[model samples]
Target: MFQFHVAPSGDDSWPGSAERPFATLDRARAAAREAGGDAVVHLKGGVHTLARPLELTGADSGITFQAYGYGTPEQEEPVISGGRVITGWQERDGVWVAEVGELDSRQLYVDGRRAERAALPGLPGEVRVTATGYVTGGGEPLGWRSPADVEFVFRGVYPWTEARCGVAGVSGDGDETVITMAQPAFGWAGELYNSTWEGQSSSGPGLPTRIENDAAFLAEPGTFVLDRSRPGRHVLMYLPRPGEHPSRTRVVAPVLERLVSVAGARDVSFRGLVFAEATWLRPSAAEGFLHYHGTGYYEGGGVETAVIGEGASVTYPAASVTIPACVTFDATENVAIEGCRFTRLGASGLGVTGGAGLAVRRCAFDTLSGAGVEVSGSRATSIEDNRVHHVGLEFSGAPGISVSGTRDCVVAHNEVAHVPHCGIVVGSGQGARILRNLVADTMEVLADGGGVYLSGPQGDSPDNQALVQGNVIKDTHTPYNFGLYTDYGASWVTVEGNVVLRADNTAVLVVGPPLENVVYRGNFWDQDPLGHDNPPSGVTYGGNVTYKDERELNAATAGIQSEAGPRR
Candidate 1:
């Protein structure tokens, strides 16, 4: 086995070893592949900027990229990033501006903290559509002079879509304004003229969006606006935090979409690295979720004032909407990513498809716009002991770990919290097990969510079931949220031995489909019992350890263990 050392100061021309370190991970990976036979590339502590992704193929098998002499992931360990740090800045018009190279960039980070896009919620008042495609609304018109440059991005009548239309101009009387949307709706969420949901109607719809690249929203420190919307001027305007000068504060914009693309690579492990600020592709479909009725997202005779509609029959962010992954794997096996920090990513952290014996464990994912990990069509894959929180920040319907079309997979010992939608969603396939993960504080944004959700979208298909057991699901306070939810068509699921501590609506929620498909046993719930929305067969609930009071329940389930036995 060969050992390669990579540092920021070393050169690719030199032999990659401890004494002569390589300058970049690309150089080290190339050396390791040539060396072959379980070569190790030890990365020294520093930030490595990646203008492009590090693509690893089958030839790079058995190569391990680990930190130099580090037991656990240190704060200052090797960070492989997809952002370009820009330093030269000159303040102009109360907004610090810096000329940038990348024009289509959307995500920006200042001193390792994400910058906020300038966005205003809700129009000042209800809008009126005129003969010309102009929308006149009586609300706070976003103050903008450059009509050709500043666009009106928004969540239209269908709250499940995030789109923008170029502004013809901003015209109105004071706060009340007539904002003209571009003909086809150009930016992120764009659809047909007057397009509504599947079963909803709308007249004058659309809320003001958090418009990036606008200088109006730069209010305080740690907030930045990348102004690429203007012609010939790709400027990044930022408000630095207190005591953080522009020269000192690192301002970065995500340039690369993927950090590592491990396709057809086997027996390779990426450990103890920080992957941050990776970009995601703009949506091709509708992606946004908002229930106009209330924050609870319940629709009990709730009128549809959001879009020009009577009532809403379809949910926003339909299951078909999907974003790209940051670290993608396909047709590869025996790969692992351990002790990594996946934070401030613009998209999903990791995705594995068509592989086996792959593992993503002991990783921390935070401030992600999409899901923590997306696993599909893989068997014997393990996702364990990871901490995923503050995910699904921008995306509407992303779960913590989305497992679909995979069998004999294990998702255990992870902590998923503060998510927008479900915690762990097992969409299809059998022999899949979701166990021992502590899922809490989920559904903070959208509605009708669950900690552990199971469903098979293919109707009347084979009995698709997953072993749901030993998880402690708690604090799902969103509307229609539950500890465990088996949606319609999610059949043959065997739920067992889970401890659910809920004070909201129900502990176990079942919705739709073949009633005889779900089985529950030996579960513990101190909260209310099952909440079945509409089941033709009803749930089969038995052998459950239930408690009335919180104190008694806590005492009874104190020493309870997962099906895998006590956590080591």
Candidate 2:
């Protein structure tokens, strides 16, 4: 196998040898292509900033990008960053301000922790929706430099979805401020969900739950607001944490959308590196963000659902959208990503679309605004032994690991926690195996999700049947969140040997939306489901044990939790 080296201190003009490494990953990729056959690129430890995404194609097949001096005394973790550090901060009235010329980003990271965008807790006063925008009945909003930069955030009709619409302008002096929303987006989201559900407010898209941005809302510590009212003189104001100073703090904002983009590639592997500090900006545009469920959204479209007895149909919109990932794989084959860390990302960590024979093992994904991993239209994929936590920071509906529209997938022995929504979700897949995973403290912010959620039909034949076995789910405290959920026409699956410690509203192995040919057997839980004594047709329950005592339930599932999660 051929070999090349890349380091932050190296130069692009170098020969990419062990002593003289290339400066960037792109140069090493070029060298690997020239070497042909099979090659390995060693990335040295340090921050390697990218101005644009590192693109790879089918010509770069049989190439492995692994860390230099891995597992050695000289090993230092490499960070591939798409962000720029903000310097030259000055103190002004207890707030630190920096001039980030022409930079526009929705997320800010200070000392490796995510800072909240300065925001008002809720809308000013009683506001009513209008066709043009909104009209406040009473509020004191007399003076402001930039009303257009302020955004109105609204919770979707469902608990899982959240939308943000831009403010075009705000007018009126004394008691009423007529806020004009950005064209098309404010109107599109309002009419699209009208009459769709009875629980929806009469105001169509509903009122803004909170207002964000503008420097006036920077009262809370550890929060930030960007003032882009001036074209080239954009200022960033941040309220620092206790005992934190501006001169000593490290602040970063994302400048690129993606760090790596692989398409039509095969036999590629990435290992033991950190992919960090990237952003996605579509949600901040005039098109706005109108989420439906689980990363699917609507832009100038509508969704229609019709439930057929033993059958269900959804007439989704023409423009079906999902959050893009910072590291994307499309139409690739035999790709492996192991022992990597993805953090401080503005969107999903990794997206695998239209790929086959993919394996992502022993990686860590956290501090993300979107899902940790999203896989769609992939075959023979195994996502095992990963640690995912603190994800869905901005988009609460995104699961830790979401797999959809796939075949022959296995999600096993992973540890997922501290998420706002589901931990591991398998939707619309065939021959799926979910086994021996540890999921805890999920569904902390959203409803109608769970620790383990399986949706849509899996397989039609016996050979391609789906199985969920030996998993441990605990601390799902939100309303309507189940311990192990099978919903939305899930069929031809067997769920067995799972342990559910504590679930508040819905109990373990809960089923909804007319399941078919599903079996639950030998599962242990603290509480029995509401209708476990008599289930609907096409669903069976046998040999499932329930222990009301906490000690008994813990004793039963202690072995499963110890064996679950990453082995190394």
Candidate 3:
């Protein structure tokens, strides 16, 4: 194997040896390509900021990027960051203000914690949706530095959907105000909502639940506002918490949308590193964000009728899109990522799409705006022994880990907690084995989801049927959420040997579309299963146990809980 070294203090012109290391990852990558054969690049400690994403294609295969002297006390995992530090702060009129010089960002992090954007509870007055925008009844519009920079945040047709739209203009003065929303985005969102299942309950994507990014709402401590009214002189205002000094605070704002992009690269691996501080800015554009479910959102025009069953269909926008990831893997083979840390991101942590022979293990993900790990259309993928929490920070619909449209995948032994939506979701996959995972405190903000959810068909033959087994799910809050959910037209799957506790609704939910050839066996829950006493057609329930409280549940499942989280 060809070995190379890279450090933050080294020079780009070096030969990439242990004694003389390269400064940037790009430099080491170039040397590895020239060296030929399998190569390993050792990344030294300290932050490595990327101006653009590290692109790896078919030419750069059989490479592994790892921390120098991994598993040793001397090795400090390097951080690959896509953010810029903000400085030159000054206290003005009881708030701190900084000049950013034409920078645009949707997220801000101070001392490793996500800082809230300036926001108000709702619109200025009693608001009503109109053909073009909204009109308030009788309240004065506050003195906003830039009305166009303001955005309206609305909960979509479903409780899990959180959407945002821009302001075209704010018209009218005293006693009443007319707010014109950005075109196409506002109109298309309404059209998309009306065509879906959730829209049947409401007239449209109604008035804004909250308004954000206006300086007038910058009273709360640890909240910020960005004023882009003046060209080349944009200002960022912040209200610091008690005993906090502006000069001592470390503020980071995302600059790049992605940190790494791997496409058609085989046998590539990354280990013992951290990916941090990337943002997806499409939601901040004029098109805005019209979220549907999970990471899928409505965009463009027109609608596609997706038939879930013989006579049942759901309307989706012309284009259903997902948030980008900080580290992306596409159409690769034999790729492995282990012992990595992902945090303070404005998008998903990792996205593995259309790949084969993939393995992701022992990773930690938190404080993200999107999903922790999102895999789709992959084959033989294994995601195990990871810890995910506090994600879906901005897009509340995103799950902790989701695998969709894959085959022969295994997700096991992971611990997911403190999420806004579901903990783990497997959809439209064949031969999937979701085993031994510990999911807790899920559905903290959204509704209509659960701790472990499965949908669509698993496989055609009995030999390839999916299995949901040996998992422990607990503390699923919010109404309409279950501890275990077999939603949509789930078939050819066996739900066995799992434990459920403290679910707000039912212990197990089997709904949406028609159930076919599904089995619930040997599972344990705090309460009796919902509607399982009289099982539905094509569904079988037998040999399941129910306990009354936590004392009884924990005494029965001690071994499963001990082996659920990361082993390392």
Candidate 4:
């Protein structure tokens, strides 16, 4: 079953059916390498422009690039696109040439004879250079000669008029003047304004332009690397809207940073796409969405995603997903990311650390700028049936699912909501199985927090065996909140038949030390008359049902028993 059709008016043979088709995707990948092995090249939707970056070499059982309808089929389905309109410019000898415009600009020759130039008074054409006083001969008049022993380069003016201007110099001594700008001029019509070194430096009119020196300018567009030290400067003339076309929202962040380094290439796939309104800067910890390093098996099917801004939607621009405090995993196993939709990412949306066995099913991680699913050092993982909602907005340390140092993990039947903190957190794990999950409006505030938060560390022995059973925690705002929180090195834990309701505070909270074996059976605590927080030992409340106000249970003793339900 092989059918190819890629417009621009088809015809490059190899049974080029669909009424004689085959425009380009490298002549349908050279007729799928002369029909020698794995196949399926059907991309017939819209836009396709790739002059470079298309490497899907030989195959040995690794290929599947699909996108042909099923769920999320709006914005004009069947679309595979690529763009390039960086036009003409040349000044080979002496660095300052232009011809890459989707929002282009060029002009560089900041040489004030052995550089050291200063003029700081509301920057009227700006100048601040010093990095061992620049000296690169030949009729020098490019300003900057010692304002603290110099090395400076600041040549500006490319807010796109289809950019084309010239001048170049960098004859050694802390050299730097590499400006290859056109990722739509810092994307979405560049307007990340506000820098005089950020905050309370009044000089407003359209405030958003800064350039400090030690000579180092590198804003590599396509391969992605938005910021690299030595006072790197950028503020390409703001244009939110006014006949907008800053290279089609800055070319959707260099085409999602070149589709995350070819998304683990090997029979690669990027189908029917439209990466709109972009801006993904500095995402590395081996980045996400699709990252598999060799040993064949890199497949990405039917991706129709959108990342507004904040480092192109994931991997901590502000924090939606950031895993890379140093990653190490060799024998990378069959990685898979199905049906994608990771919107408004930031502050831990889906971060799995140092992968071993990762799986994020039926993906739909919510409007985040932080926390909705963060698993650390993954090993034998399975975050099943996901439908995680609008998590903590960068405040109460957001949690809707946070597991640490993973091993044999299983956070089953998920459906968590507007979390502020702790909706299901098993920190520093071992044998974890937080079964049948359905936690609601979990722990917002009241100092430390819980809706099923089990902690570890403080004499070890905690990560042995954990099981917070049959979950269904209800509306909790916080008042020393607890629906099931066990601290102090939890060992062999179990909180059965869960259904804790509208608790203002405390339903079952056992803190630090004394847990050799803990169990609270047949649960149904609908307390809110302010109760709970002190049961460090002997916790085995059977056939549970403490309706409310039994004189606030008068600080239960005598093996605590009150059984009686049906009063709100």
The number of residue pairs in model 3 that clash at the backbone is 0
Model 1's lDDT to the true fold? 0.68
Task: Residues 1-568, candidate 3: write the lDDT tens digits.
Answer: 9999999899998889988999999998888899773899999988898878999998899989999988787877799999989899988888988999988888999988899999988876577789888888744443666888888888646576788898888767566788888877898777776533423334457878888998888989999998888999999888898877877888888889899999999999999999998888888788898888898888876776565444444556777888888899999999999899999899999999997999998999999999999999999999999999999988999999999999999999999999999999999979999999999999998898899988899888789889999998999988888899988888999999898888975454346576788988988888887787778887888998888877877888887777676676
lDDT of 3: 0.86
Which of the two candidates, 2 or 4, achieves a greater TM-score against the reference? 2
lDDT of 1 by residue, 1-568 (tens): 8999998888889998778889988888888877874798898888887768999998899999887876743434888888877867888766677887555565777777777665544344566555333455554444653444454445424432333344555676655577665443332222222444566554433455444435665666677665555566677777766787766667778878789898888899888888887876443112222222111121122232223234433333221334668888898889888888888888888888888999887889888877889987887898888898888766656678888888778888888888877888877676777888888888676666588877763223234356788888878865666778776566667788888877355455444444455677788887656543332464667788778786887677665534332133
In model 2, what are the clashing residue pairs, if there are any?
Answer: none
Candidate 3: misplaced stretches above 4 Å? 138-142, 195-201, 304-315, 507-510
All candidates in order of TM-score, best leading? 3, 2, 1, 4
What lDDT score belongs to each candidate, Candidate 1 first?
A: 0.68, 0.85, 0.86, 0.41
Tens-digit lDDT track for model 4 on 351-386? 555445555565555544345666775677777666
- Please give the lDDT score at residue 549 for candidate 1: 85
RMSD of each: 5.7, 2.5, 2.4, 20.9
lDDT of 4 at 560: 20
Specify the poorest-scoring 10-residue window by lDDT in model 2.
307-316
Q: Over the stretch 1-568, how does candidate 2's per-residue lDDT look in tens digits?
A: 9999999999999999989999999989988998893999999898999988999999999999999976577766999999999999989999999999999888999989999998886666687778878888654443545777887777745666677788888788466888888977787776555443433234346877778888878889999988888999999999998989877888999889899999999999999999999998887788887776777777875555443233433233456689999999999999999989999999999999997999999999999999999999899999999999999998888899999989999999999999988999999979999989999999988787889998889898778979999898999967877888888789988998888878874343334467898888888888886568788887888998999998988888788667777777
Query: Would you estimate the TM-scores of all the predictions?
Result: 0.84, 0.95, 0.95, 0.25
| lDDT of candidate 1 at residue 261, scale 0 to 100 | 93
Worst 10 residues of 4 by lDDT: 157-166
Q: Model 3: how large is the Cα RMSD against the reference? A: 2.4
Cα deviation of 482 in candidate 1 (Å)?
A: 1.6
